[model samples]
Target: EMGHVLGIGTLWDTFGLLKDFPGPNPTFVGPGAMKEFGTLIGAGQPTPVPVANVGGAGSAGGHWRERVFGNELMSPTIGGPGNPLSRLTVASLGDLGYQVDLDAAEPYALPDPFVIAMAGGGETAPPRGVMLPTVPSSVPADRP
Candidate 1:
């Protein structure tokens, strides 16, 4: 469980708010063992369906169970090993649009997820003026 939780954390740490930050690639520990286990499970599985007609005709009823039972367990903020991030905000600044993705990793993995800020603007000036830009000093250079 901890490995799965860490994997989720690694995913968030790499792709979370700080989109510039890198890392969180998976490292396969046991390639042979994992493949063998998968093969064993697949050996006794149902017959293979043709790729073209996999979801043939009457598959609507199959989804009924998910639609009914899934909604009951829905949560506004359910963080776990699988769900790593959530889009929390979308707002416009001047002419630019901004989006925020939050890391929803477990509490233990990341006690406090870092917050990152990013800005985007149009071809001209952004909706909000240039955040920080060089400005010519009003004071004459010779005076000082």
Candidate 2:
């Protein structure tokens, strides 16, 4: 994946953006991505974006958790609402030390996990504008 090539997760430590790695809660602390993640989820304050710890080597530590981000472009797995290229990914690039235009980012938001679990039929990601920070026990609760 292009994100892998850019080291979004793979080089997190190298960039000094990762903390508490290889544990129960490895987090991505890139300021830009953190801020954007909060914005994407409507969290008024910056929130820590989670780095995946599943799917083995190529995917585990090299991509956003599939459960949390759902079909996000950088998620380990693929399948969701178009896998929209939301500002979350763009901001991550900025965190990776690349200049970017937040304005140019396409609008995207996660689906409600509760609703998704309840629906038991469709999308399982956080909903747009209402990205939740925690997944209820009933939900899969993947790393993101």
Candidate 3:
């Protein structure tokens, strides 16, 4: 995906944005993403972006955790009618040394848990771009 091509999740640790990798609670600690995350989720203070840590060798350490960022473009499991690339994702690109325009990011929001539960645990992804390719069941030989 373009996110990988742009080194979004892939370059996190290399760029010093990833923390506690290969653990139960890997997180992204980039200032730009952290600041945007708080605003995205309506938290009063900056928040660490949760990173995937359970999807095995190719996935675990290289994506936003689906539990929190469900259906967002950078998360691994994309069951989409649509997927939006959020500002939090775009801001992290700034942490990676790219001169990015946050305005270029598509609008997105975390699905409200109360709403999800009430609706029987189905997600309603915000319509934006078409669906992204799902992570293959097996990791490709080409990727590390």
Candidate 4:
């Protein structure tokens, strides 16, 4: 699972206090995803609703569920032959206070699972690409 700060704002603050940096603190798009696609509001929103992560922190459970995200890169498991680099992730980077090349981000369709069975037998998700972006020098160095 991908391990990151609970939210982009947290990451920003940590870097700011530690490295004496300046920039907008990360923020969510809104309470939820926007109704329309490819849009950003004037003011930033709250962070996305994270997975409960009830048992403990930072394990295989640290990421979005595969059953829910299908082949999205942040999903805990990568069992599929192909992986999808979701726009959500890119937007999340924007939330993390980085300049994103949205055009370079791979598009993804959120999954629509009518029924999620306990077993692995369920609807199949669409394929997505592996989109990676470079963090500019203005941003904090990647740290564990």
Best-performing candidate as measured by lDDT? 3
How many clashing residue pairs appear in each of the predictions shown?
Answer: 4, 7, 0, 3
| Ten contiguous residues minimizing lDDT sum, candidate 3 | 119-128
Q: Would you list the C-alpha lDDT of every candidate in the order shown?
A: 0.21, 0.75, 0.83, 0.43
What order do candidates take by lDDT, descending?
A: 3, 2, 4, 1
- Which segments of model 2 are wrong by more than 4 Å? 115-144
TM-score for candidate 1: 0.14
* RMSD for each of the candidates: 21.8, 12.9, 13.6, 19.2
Per-residue lDDT of model 2, residues 17-53, tens digit only: 8887677677788888889888877889899897776
Which candidate ranks first by TM-score, i.e. highest?
3
Q: Which stretches of candidate 4 lie over 4 Å from their true place?
A: 1-47, 50-56, 59-61, 114-144
Residue range 24-106, candidate 4, lDDT tens digits: 12122322222112332222543332321222233122344445565666655566666665656555555455666656667
lDDT (0-100) at residue 52 of candidate 3? Answer: 83
* Candidate 1 local lDDT, residue 105: 18
Q: Which stretches of candidate 3 lie over 4 Å from their true place?
A: 115-144
Clashes of 1: 4
Question: Candidate 3 lDDT, tens digit per residue, 41-79?
Answer: 789788999898766556788888876787788887777
Clashing pairs in 3: none
- TM-score pick, better of 1 and 3: 3
